[model samples]
Target: GAALRTLTEATTPALARRVAALVQEAVRLRPETAGQVAGCVDRRLEQGPTARPVLLPLVTGLLDGGPEQVRAALATVLAAAGTPASRPLRRELLESLLDRERDPAVLDAVLHAAAAQGDADMDRSGGGDMGRSGAGDPVEAPYRREDEIRGLVHRTGLLLVRTPEGATLLDRGLADLGRHVPGFAARMARWLTEAPDDWAGMVGPGARRTIENLAGVRVPA
Candidate 1:
């Protein structure tokens, strides 16, 4: 509560960023502090449009921390940004996080946030294409969004083949998306199947087997 009050009163970007960083650090050290961090973020976000610059660095910098810390920071931000007022910033942060995050739990959180947003966006559009090209021209259609999601999923799949906890993270994300965004999971599976390079070469141990199991194609021996 004090952190949030201080953040609400923060007058300069420097001060705001510093406070945000401390909040993340606290969450990292003590996950029980996540509620406080979320509260601080929510208060800062309520400060209006100017909060973006302050929050951007705070949210993005969490990825540079240890995996557990990153997961903590992601959970904090995702919970705080669930409001309509924070939707735009949340989307931006989600995209940025998904773009570079390598940790499985963090990636899973990002995908969940994106899928939730997509569900909302789709609902608001009444399930219609958002004024894009016709179905006949897939290339000219609204592809930028799809491309971003695809790249993130592909990168995560690569990690799934590499990291020890990758399968657990992916399985969790798949289960979550299966409920809210079934197509997202399908897209990830498709990307894994059509990966440009061999997943085995990306990292050591469990790589080939994981890829083979998920993608249903054996790596040549």
Candidate 2:
């Protein structure tokens, strides 16, 4: 618990990453301690966005080879930290892992992580049915600041839709939100409606196609 606390409490990004590396090393050298390490990592992740950069390398590095328990724990951390605010970081980590991660359990965790952020947004908007009266109005939900919307669009263009696998995951993740959160699709549409022209310029053609084809997302024209 001390080590976990230290890992999470590290104030700087470099410190956090260093602590994660040490935990990875510990997990490597002592398989029996995987649970403790994972627990610590999970706790740090639950602390929210600040832990993401620290947790990113730990999740990606450990995914390739580790005790099953260790990998599963890392996957859980990844899913929790996988928010759009983390954006390209989360997408980058997941894309790399999905390409090579062969463990079914680990892969399942990756997919689950991908949807975590979108689900969070859905919940914040209230998880009512889409056709439900309160569901479709963006005014009813918490507003996303311009910077947040920019980050989301940036990820959509630069990372999530850059590859087939990422595009698929992005599409699926949002769709899941729409299904579970109701009116989430409309809310997303409203959010994007305010994206500045520069945000559109940030997106590439492939990403535009993915957004159009899969989510029918409206972008600044």
> Which ranges in model 1 have alpha carbons more than 4 Å from their true place?
2-11, 28-30, 35-49, 60-102, 132-142, 179-182, 185-221
Q: RMSD for all candidates, in order, please.
A: 6.8, 9.5
Give each model's clash number. 0, 1
Candidate 1 per-residue lDDT, tens place, 14-124, comes to: 665565566556666767655555456556666556678777776555545533654545644653325446656766766676566666665555546545544554554
Candidate 2, residues 26-108, lDDT tens digits: the string is 76777666666756655555555776777666665566555666775665554453333454454555556556655544544
What is the Cα-based TM-score of model 1?
Answer: 0.58
